[model samples]
Target: MKIIDAHHHTWDLSVFPYSWMNNPHPTGDISHLKNNYLIDDLLEDAKNLELIKSVHIQCQGGINSPVEETEWLQSLSDKQGFPHALVVYSDFLREGIEKEIEEHCQFKNTRGMRYLLNYINNDPINCFAPKEALLDTTFKKNYSLLEKYNLSFDMHLWWTQYSYAFDLIKSHPNILNIINHAGTPRKRDEEYLSNWRNGLKTLAQAPNTVIKISGLGMFDQQWTTDSIKPLVLDCIEIFGINRCFFSTNFPVDKKYSSYEKVWNSYFDITKDFSIDEKEKLFFKNAEKYYRI
Candidate 1:
C-alpha cells in the first residue's frame, strides 16, 4: 500500500545539537540513537516499504533553538523533496511565543508545534516539563497563539495527564490537536492499561483531535505483535479509521524494532479491516490532516 509516514525525524549531529541524544539522563538512555540520521538514512531504513512522504516531528534540537531544526529541514526539503510537514518545537512558558511563532511560520511547511508536556509527579526521570505545565496559565496563553498561525498542536503528555489534556482540547475546539504515542500507556498493569484505554476514548470524543499511533517501544521496550495489537486496534476502534494514522517514531523506536517490523506489526494487527479503512490508516488520513 502507499504510505505517508505521519511522524518521524531526521538529525545530523554535526550540524545540529540534540542534547537528549548526547547526554540522556540515566532514565532516558537513548544513547543507541546518538548517531546522525539524515534523510538518506531514513530512506535506506524504509527501503522495503512504500514511503512516499513523511512529517518530521521535532527531534530534541536543544531548548534554545527549536526552530533551527525546522530551518534545517526546510533546507533539506528545498533540495530533496520529502518531509512534507514540519512539526517544530517551542516552549510555551517562555517569553515571546508570538515572535517565535512568526519566526517558525516564515517557513511555509511549518504545520505544527510540539512542546513536550510529558510530566509526571515524583517522576523527574521521565518528565519533560514541570508538573503543572498543563495547568499553568502561561501555557494556555502561549498555546493560544497557534490559532493565529494556523498551526496544529502536538500533545505528548503521559496518559495520566489525559484528562487535563482533554480539558485543554475542549477549551480550544478549533485547534487541531494530535495526540502522540497512543496516549503513552507507560505500564502494562491491568489498571494502567484500563485507564489508558478510557483516556483515549475520552480524547477521541473531541472531533478536532486525532491520534497518531507511534512509539509503543517507549512504553513496552520489548514489544511484540501480540503485545501491541490490542493497543493498536483499540486506538483505531476509538478514533475510527478516519481519525487515526500510523507513524514510526523511528531511530528512537529503532531501539526496540526496525522500521519494517513496526509497520508490519501494524498491518498484522489490522489485517481484517477493509482495504479503504487500511488506506486511511496508512496514508489518506495523514494526507488530509497535514495537508500533504
Candidate 2:
C-alpha cells in the first residue's frame, strides 16, 4: 500500500507571509489552517504507514517574494528528508516571473509552479484571480516558459474554469498539467454537478492533464467515506486509472478528518480495484508525473 501524496502543503506562518491563512474563508471556518504545519506534524497525522513520498504544493507566500517559499521548503527537505519535491508559487501577473522561476529552480527539489486560477461570479471574495486570468497574454507567456525549465503546472481552478484550463493546456502539450482538488468542486447541486461532469470529461480529453482526487473536505466538511466515494470514483472513471491519483491535501483538509482517516477512506472506497489499479492511484502515477 505504498503512497505518494500528489498534492499537499507544509507551511510555517512565522517564517513566511502565508498571507491567505488569515483571510476570511469561503467554506466557513478555516481556523484549523491558520497554524504552522511542519514535517513531523504531517508524518504523525498520516500514521506513517505507507506515505513513502510527498509533493508540497505552494501555500501562498509573500506576494512579492514567492520564491522564498521554495527556498524554505528546500531547506526543510534538506533537514527532514521528505516532501520529495516542491511546487512553489509564481505570480504571472507581476513582472520578473522568469526570475522567480529561475530562483525556484536553483533549489534541488523544485518540480513545478502553482498559480491558482479559481474565480466565480458569485464567490467573488474567494476568487484567487479575476475573470480570464488564465487567458491573459502575460500569464500564458510566463506559463509557457515552464517548458524550458522542464517543470509541470499544478493548476488550481474551479469547475467553471475547466474550459479555460483546457484552452491553456491544449497549447502546452509538452508540460504536464496536474489538476488540483478534483477541479475544485464548490457546489454539489444537480445543476452544478451536471455542468461539473461535462467540464471534467472535456478536460480529460487533454492527455497532458491529470486529476488529483483531493480537497473533498472543502465542500463536504462533514464527509464520510460514503459521501466522497462517488467523487473519487467519478474522477477515476472519467480520467481512467492511469491518469488519476489520490492526495490527502493535509492540514488544510485536516479541517475534515485525521490523515489516518483520510487515507483509510481512500483505501476503503477503492477496495474493489485490482492491485495494479490501486498501486497507480496510490503511488505510481504520482511518482511518474511528479518525477519523485
Candidate 3:
C-alpha cells in the first residue's frame, strides 16, 4: 500500500543551532543524530521505505531565524521535490501575526502552523494556549484568519494538556487541528499509561481533530513495535481510520531507532488492519488532512 509520512523533519546543523540535540539526555539508540539531515537523506530513506510523500515539520532551530523553515522547505520542494506539505511554526503570541500568516500562506506547500506548548515549568500550561491570545479582542477579531487563509493548526502540546487544546478547537471548529504524535504519551511508567489513555480518548472525541500516530519511538528509549501497538491500535479504535494518520517522525525519532526500523515497526503493528483502513492511516488521511 502507498504511504504518506505526515510528520517528519529535516535540519542542517551547519546553518542553525539545535540546542536540544546537544543536551546529554538519555535518548536510547539515537544519540548519533546530532547533525543535519538534508533532502537527499530523507529521499533515500523514503525510497527504501516505499513512501509516496512526506510532510516536513519544522525543527525548533529554524524558529526565530530569518530564513523561515517552511519557506526553506518550499524552496526544497521546488528544487529537490519530496515534501507534499510543510508544517511551520509560528508564535501566535506575537504582534501583527496575521501578516506573517498571510506571507506563509503564499507558499503553495504551506500546510499549517505548529505551536509547541510542551511546558514543564510549574506554569499554567493553558495560559499559553492560542485561544489565550484570541482573548485579547484584537487577536480574537482576527481568529478566523487561519481559515481565511486555509491553514490548519498542528498542535505539539503535552498529552496532559490535550483537554485545553480540545476546548480551544471547539471555539474554532473550522480550523483543522492535527494532533502530533498521538499527543506524545509518556511510556516510562505503568502509572502514566492510564492517564495517557484517558487523555487520548478525550482528544479523539473532537471531530475537527486528527490524531497523528508518530513519535512513538521517542516516547521511551527502549520502545519496540510490540510495546507501542496497544496505544496505536487504541487510537485507531477511538478516532477511527478516517481521523487517524501515520508519520515517520524521522531524525527526531532517530534518537531511539533507525528510520527503516521505525517504519518497519509501524508496518508490523498495522499488519492486521484492513487494507482500506491501513491506506487511510498510512496515506489517504494525511492527504486529506493536509490537503496535499
Sort by TM-score, best first. Answer: 2, 1, 3
User: How high a TM-score does candidate 1 get?
Assistant: 0.96
Stronger candidate by lDDT (2 vs 3): 2
Q: Write the per-residue lDDT of candidate 3 for residues 19-105, one digit (tens) a residue.
A: 656544323444567777888888777677677888988776565742377677788889877787988766665666777777777
Error of 2 at 105 (Å): 0.5
Pairing residues by index, what is the TM-score of model 2? 0.96
Name the runs in model 1 displaced over 4 angstroms. 22-28, 62-64
Model 1 backbone overlap count: 0
TM-score of each: 0.96, 0.96, 0.87
Model 2, residue 199: displacement in angstroms? 0.5
RMSD of 3: 3.5
Write down the worst ten-residue block by lDDT for model 1. 19-28
